[model samples]
Target: MCRLAMKTASKPFSPFSVLEAMEAMQEGYDGSGLGLLLRGLEFAEYKYNAKDPILSGIAHSEAALARLNKIMIEAGFELKYDHEFDVKRQMIEAKDRFKYILRVYKQSATWASLSAEEVENRLMLTRLALRKDGEAHGQDLTVFSLWPDVAMIKEVGWPLGVGQALGLDSGRITSRICMAQGRQNTNYGINLYACHPFFIQGVATMTNGENTAFIPIKDWLSGRGFPGYIGYQSDSEVFAHILHYVTKQLKLPLETYKHVITPLKNEELAAHPQGDFLRGLRDACRRLIIDGPNAVIGTLPDETSMLVMDAKKMRPATVGGKPGEWAIASEMCGVDAMIPDRDRSKDFQPMREHTVIIPPDRQELQIWSQFDHLPIHQAA
Candidate 1:
């Protein structure tokens, strides 16, 4: 099993707060690896450069770094600001392999002339091309994300130790939302690309539990002819892709995501008001149905955060906090560590049939059930 924690607030706070919550649940996960995704960045420079895309990754050598620069330049991207972590050798494992990088880039001169859809497609394609070139030459270059106001850091080591090495403990890397995972290596080897909080376009997700239906879902996603869906380093990566496909590609509402991935049974659908529409969706997205004992936490491009559970609800998770602040975690201990003063009486543990949603405004939490009525016109 693995541990997951998320922190969201109306204003930006240090990423260290989320790491501290993960530390509280250390017993649930081994110190194999740590992955973090920070969105709604509050860096001083980002205030003025919010439109630029920020590239986050790790380069194994100087040659790999040079190659990345060359690729970005060739793709019509201009470097704006570069921020590389001063990784502490003594604090982290595998000192030789952790050259962390975060750089901002301005799009090409013609970027302003493209449609919204065209710009999104270009960003994803460029990131995929960079990943392919790096892998082909064994450059040990990994690109985690290329989006505005988002930064992802992943490394192998204890949660806090890795956070310290990445300079997260300094309380400077702040964001309005942060999702992190303390990975417990179970099936796969420790590969940095296989870390949690997988990202594509603007959709990001991190999950706990093995996805038994990974291959089928991955195949369906790749066949859709999208370049960003190529990497399948982790079974859970498909969760993010599935989200991107449903919301971005298909242009569906956020609630439709839960319907696609964990559809209601025929019997359960019969009880819903939009049974006919749901039945049709179930048939159309059959291959995307996930089968496994998993709990997922993710954020949408608009900053909406969600916590979802599989039909069986085998994994543990909780959501708690007061107004203007909230936290979701794999265990209650993690929540307590983040906001001890929260109203314990109002804490919620979503059942197998529920999806807990917190909109970008951070005002209230909405719990939508699989049996809830969805307007057919919204999906139409």
Candidate 2:
């Protein structure tokens, strides 16, 4: 079992809050690892450098750090601000991994002349190159995310312990939205890249159950001709890539994500108001459909957050809160831990036919069902 906790608010909040929610449901996870993805940053430096992409990752040695800086400079990326967190001895699962880097960089001059999509592609390519160089040369560097106003951290340890080790509670690292996971080692050995809260471009996601359909899903995504989809360290990583594929590549509406990943059955589709459209979608994207017991919590580039389940709905999940603050978690107790003052009566537990969505505004909650003609909205 694993636990997921996601929180979004009208203003910046501490990442520790998300971890606290996950810790409240620790019984479900084994404490094998903890992963976090933060968006809409509120750090003091962020106010001045919000447009600069932050390269966040781990470096094993001073040589590795120097090599990374050299590469970025040669590539024309100018470093504007840098912050490093020296990992506590107790949090070091690998002796070589010593610190985390949150370095902000201004793109090369060429970026000024390129289209928005071209600029994004350039950033992704640079990150991929850095990751490949590290692996090939044994530099022991791992870059998790390189996007503006976003940061990611992953380590092999208990939730609160890892958070404390990284000094996340010091009130310096905060965001308007945070997605975190307390991982349970199940199908694979403990690997940092395999941790949850997987991110690509600006899309981020974490999962709580095994993806029996991982192989097919990975294959389909790898064949999409996107270089960023190459890393499949964690089977659940496909969830985030799929989300990016549907929303960004395919240009589909966010609500259609639930339909593509957990499509309605043929019989159920026949009765849906959008049956004809969903039928074509299901058939066209059949390879992306997920199986087994899984619950996914994710955030998009626009700051929207969502929680969805597999067709089986075998995993526990819920969404609840008040205006300007909302949370989606794998357990109701997790929600209670995050927002105790919330209206408990309005708490929603999504089933096989439902998806819970919180828009970027943070002013309302939406529950979209496959069986309904439209989503049901609940005002804050």
Candidate 3:
């Protein structure tokens, strides 16, 4: 009964309450340019004022462009107020505006002198785009990735002076923002239907005392369920590359893996199943390698088998995939990305893999999922 109560206590007041809170907080900090807190808040208000979602979203988006200009001034970038972002119809239709913005940042937007405010904007944008885990979620179900780099800030002249915010990549940052904002104005990381955003299991990261590295796993994190332990393999980059290559040797796409590993539609998965075998599960992934689908087939223990069985059904372009929940970081010294692949593929040649499908609206979900599982104190 105490265990049941514990679970009940963990439930949210209402499904949308988390989103409301997130949006409210976001709206409360409206600033332009590097002050993403400010811009996000204003953007939230713009959405709240709308009568129609489609139009409201557009309104908020237009305001973002306007805010981009304001941010330029606030950051003291080379933009001038008499500026113009010559968004061509064809270019807009293609939905690739980052290059265009960078090409004309100074000429197409507002200009000003750098200030603490610009530094502030740069930092905010950088943090939003660089973090390893998702920050926004809905009822802690649909977790998604936020930054893979920093196009949104770069396009607008990288408001955050801190190296373009989130590790120096234009496309990565834009993808992060686009994912978080989605099609609606304020999804704000709430899991509505126990779907993708509510849960996922892939590469994640954590720092070690001496170095940083990746922990690979056929992770089953989310509203979904699978049997296994959380394991550590190597440093982050090496782990990422191997899993990618193994998925290629097999025919599974990443989405298919997500669906199976952290499924929503699969009736086969039973939530909160009986078991206290977590410690054993966690220890299983210590340095496991994938040699190829055929060779890797029977090598794993039951936990590994379960993870691989599901992952194999819907895999990505990877050669070495561990079975568990783990994250990877670049600084893990005991690891190198390429050799793991070499070992995994030495026995066999890699074959083509399926493609993964990524939608634009899953960012808020990813951010939310990252913290939902934490203890209240950890969350804070």
Candidate 4:
């Protein structure tokens, strides 16, 4: 009935490996679809030093491919690598198969002086533009993510079988952070764009429960005057965009995102020295507040991975690891599959109102409390 996700500290493990972990917890998900996003990729060595955007998606037809090529060229993007998924090697085939394209773009000289934030924004707009173009032209194009050091693969199938079908070299194809979601169709039809592990710019998020506050949140975000905020295939996609809006757009600290999405009670806020400051933020972004019973796992642009629960903590999540590696998931089985050697007693779960932030270095875990006035307590 929910989704699952996991990430490592620094090691570049295979995305297929992540898929396997999700497969272990498959009982909770119906496997209507599978979505994978990888950052700090190991297979594409050139991408580490490459300064351009790497975009991947499913192109529904040959005309869609031609149109995409035209759009990219018109936008002053020169292709570095253009590839098609090798469907011949896959284990299963759908009644309607989409041609998967992964292209790395070398931006024109005009983009040389763009700031890091601007460059990221450009990639996002480019990807969203492509999706919109595809839709307008009657093409089923779904761009997963467009950025350097990233690649995404998603399809409608079983998790384990989809993993096997990729036919990637397990040793070579890896990333520092990879997310997989075994989707259970609840609201939307079986659209590939509706799959979870949604990514925008560098922020990626997957949720394990339905987001009851999605419509108001979506409406608020769409009104923010940003072109990239138009799509809403999955209600959970708003979480990913909110991460971008909070950290990149508003120039707010990452912790503030937790508060914006799930603000504390006025009574709890009154006890803190920064109570008024927090209250102003809640009032300004009231529509963004989430109604939970949702467990969220996400990765930020700076490589920080996070695990958060809504006020009720209706969905389960566990964070555990040894010294150099830590991971979070909606189930203990997921964490166990990622780092089985770690001491089980050390596993910690965030309570109903806490955000557990794990940095890339994996040196320590930082728990941010919405209820800052009270002492912190881990879920037992």
Number of the top candidate by lDDT? 1
Which should have the higher lDDT, number 3 or number 4?
Answer: 4
| lDDT per residue as tens, model 1, 203-320 | 9999989899999999998898878888787899999999898889888777888999888889888877887888898899999999979999989988999999988888989999
Clashing residue pairs for model 1: none
**lDDT per model vs. reference:** 0.86, 0.85, 0.20, 0.77
Model 4 TM-score (2 dp): 0.92
lDDT of 3 at 26: 36
Q: How many collisions between residues are there in candidate 3?
A: 74
Ranking by TM-score: 1, 2, 4, 3
The model with the greater lDDT, 1 or 4, is 1
Off by over 4 Å in 2: 374-380
After TM-score superposition, the amount by which residue 28's alpha carbon in candidate 2 deviates from its true location, in angstroms, is 1.3
lDDT of 2 by residue, 73-106 (tens): 9889998877766347766565777568888888
Best by TM-score: 1
> What does the lDDT read for residue 99 in candidate 3?
25
Q: Where does model 1 exceed 4 Å of error?
A: 44-48, 375-380
The local distance difference test score of model 1 is 0.86
For model 2 the local lDDT of residue 118 reads 88
Cα error of candidate 4 at position 125, Å: 2.0
Q: Write the per-residue lDDT of candidate 4 for residues 1-380, one digit (tens) a residue.
A: 66586877576777777777787798888877788887776554444444557888877777787888898899999987665444544475564445677677787678889987677778878888888887887656667778887778888788778777656434546778887788735688877778888887778888888888989999999999988787787888899888888887877777778888888788988876677778887898888988877888888766788888887888999999876688787788998888888898989999876888888787778887875542212111
List the lowest-lDDT window of 10 residues for candidate 3: 1-10
